[model samples]
Target: MQGAIARVCVVVVAAILNHPLLFPQENTTLPDQDKELMARMREHEEKLEMEQAKLEKELSQLESKQEESSSEDGYSWYFWSTLSFVIFFTIELYRVDLTDTEIKPVEDEDVFSESGSVTPRTMVLDKDVLSNFCDKCMYTSSHENWRVREFVEGFADDLLESLRSVCDRDADMEVGDFVGIGSMFESWKVCKPLMCDLIVPFSPPDPYSFQFHLWCSPSSDVPPGLQGCGKIKVTKFGENEKGCLCGSANMGDDMLCLLHSRNDTPKVDHSPDELLCSRNTPFLAKDQVMKWFQISVTKAWGRISHKYDFEVTFRNLDAAGALTIRFRSGKVIMLNIIPVVQLEDTDAYFVSHFPSDCDSPPDPYWPLSFAVYEKNLLKHFAKRLPQNSCHLHCLQIVTFLHRKQTGLTGKSALTNYHLKTALLHLLLSKKPSVWGVESMEHRLRDLLSFLQRSLQEKRLHHVLIGNSKVPGDVQVPLIIRKAEPINLLRPLVLQRELHAATVRHFTKC
Candidate 1:
């Protein structure tokens, strides 16, 4: 538009200059045609000027319209952006509210298939509800449970100390430090009985030491049923034979300690008869130990019976040291004081029976217990896991559920130890981040699903034995870690009815 206006102005100026009206030659006369042409040029100049003014006005209007349109676009963008942010915030608040308030029964049909079996893949947990229950009922956060534990443990300590003193004074068996194990000590106890499982390690007096013969060793001829068991040999130090009395004086041909004359009959001694081993055998015997322990406990209680108003009695005659203490206030606390032989100063012990064993293991062979190491493994992971981790919570919840289910359906092949084993396996397999307190529900579901799969496969291996996933920081003996993984669910393989019952119990749980 400007260019056209400029062209018109140039034409007008040229026409006026060439007309001889503005810059005239001297003595020049204009003809009529020339005068007419000058008037026409003036008219054309006026028209061009008007057209230039109209073009300028249109340019100004177009610029104003463009500015208005840009302003409207800016307002629209801001409005939409603010609206989107508000909507997102509102949705987040609603979602959180639902998560907190929504609580549903776990036995929903969506968790199972039409065939009434749990479909592991589609299973889900109501995180908020489960977490709430765990925090309220399962964890040791309750003051009543804590106080009971403290009171029971304090009384038990005094009781065990008295028992140790009695054993040392009257019997040859010397009680060592008591190792705390099981769910109570592990801070996962969720049910009644409020039991404290203690491993009382005892050694022989004076010159005696324990020699362990593990079934996993190359020289072992142990039966298949005794896979995780061992035989403990009571041997005397500095002597080739077990409990042998032959000394240096009889080293050569004498074959007898001879500080006296030959006619002085061999010093009659029957102390070996009082030892923990079987008659005429160096191997430790479970029956002998139990009998001796029962007597010792009775004597110990007799000595301390005057101090307390509670009565302590054997919970089971078959179990070596299962005791129940009943207070005058009607509070009953169970104590399992298992006598164990330490395996070469390691965390492992050759226990008379595993707490989870359903049948009595053979008397000659003692089952190996990694309970101490299990406790240590949990402590080792404490630093690695998030603060207030849900790992233990998940375990407690499952075990509590299993206990309730068992009460409803009677005994089954599944045990608490199996549930704990499954949890330990998941702890190793999953990342530490997965065990945060916020993830309790998810972890609980994962644990159940893992158990379901293990049950289906009929294989739930021991966590400490032959498990490569265990962290090196745990104090597991190298031999046990390298040994073949023993299946905790092996009974299910041999007994189909037991397997079916166990599966039903687990599903109900």
Candidate 2:
């Protein structure tokens, strides 16, 4: 150790002497300050030489057996070694802190986007250091990602295959009886894919029909501009559900005769306020569809070999309607197969039901979802982007911190899905160059600031809505074009006390 220190000092001194910054030409003029600085450098060099000499003397003493006897009399050497290692590891993780002072925040515009975006200032963070930190996180998270996805998705495929085999014989189902339609299927998810969102589309027997419903303030007249809610209209009602427009005299001609028009099948007793469709009460009831999935999927899962090596067995199906895929290996994932409706043009009806819905609306039209389109939009935007674009790293970093501070739960105001939407919108606004890895800190600050502004304003336009900047060439519903911006953070905004709480959360920073 003494010899290594001596060699390091020699190299540093040699480099300083050779360094161009240290030299001044004979003809060059120098201020008194410059002269004093140069003198200080010379003194520093001399002091280093003296220190090196003292180190060598100590090394000589240690080489002698007398010093060895003194070392043996002290505490264990590994104690100091472990302490040094912990310190080294802590230094490496310094950048992971959200409040790292190197990030210079850009000012956001309070007014709507008129001309340009918030221009980020060039930050002075060490490029190599930031890259190293991100690389380390990504390496470990990638491994955890695979285990959850592999186990969950493998089970999903087998389940889907079983549904296909049965649906082939069961003439009542077609086109929409699918499951597991969200983020778990995507490759960009980080850490372990802890949760899965499954959407089993309700295939109401034909002639019953379905139409998309926009939850616009239960008022008698809707605004012409349709602000606050979206359109879900042929563009809405399923092709077969759109009768006469599907180039057929009867849209139900090819469909099964399970229409409520006939009295052959008895109607299941339901409460009057339960939002049953007036035209077809028996066939396409949302609650009944949910009940069917709960029973059938559970039965199918039970018939499969349960005592597998990985030990994935039939966990109970949720009462409200979703299949829960549990794992005996580890509590790494929570998978749910949800029952949903597939509208040709699904609208933004439930922006108020964020985090998680507090109340179930008495509507027969099962609210539609745009999970498929969102994934496609992200996948397309990422195609030409550089591998290390901060467009991704910003999200990965923020999400890592978010999970640490709170968690990946619907109970919180923040969510990974919201972050994903923010990134998509930013991609639409900013040029590709702005998302480079070098701009990570600035980009991340920008996203946080944007979210902060959204929370304050109580307005976060749905990505599927045509109001915000939609990505080029991505098809969206026409109703989305006419929809007014909704207050997605309304629930959070309603509580005055939460403002202080939100401020505290934002300051984590």
Off by over 4 Å in 1: 1-111, 121-124, 139-142, 168-171, 241-273
Clashing pairs in 2: 233-236
Candidate 1's residue-wise lDDT over 1-509, tens digit each? 33333433444444444433333332133354677767776676667567656665765665565434355556664565566556556756775565444433345665777767665466666677786777687753557667766876676677677778776543468877677799888888888878888888888775577888898998997898768998988876656744434433346664555434446544222255576777788889988888887787788788888988888899888777888989888988888888888898688888876555668677678888898888888887888999989998888888888899888988888888888889888888889988999887778778988999999999999999999888888868888888998988888999999999889888867
Write model 2 residue lDDT over 383-439, tens digit each, in one string: 767676777677776677666656422235656766677777777778876777778
Against the hidden reference, what TM-scores do the models get? 0.71, 0.58
The runs of at least 3 residues in candidate 2 whose Cα sits more than 4 Å from the true structure, single-residue gaps closed, are 1-130, 143-151, 163-182, 216-288, 310-331, 345-362, 407-411
Worst 10 residues of 2 by lDDT: 347-356
The C-alpha RMSD of each candidate to the native structure, in angstroms, is 23.0, 15.4
The global C-alpha lDDT for each of the candidates, from Candidate 1 onward, is 0.76, 0.52
Residue 338, candidate 1: how far off, in angstroms? 0.8
Native-to-model Cα distance after best TM-score fit, residue 399 in candidate 2, in Å: 1.7
lDDT of 1 at 232: 86
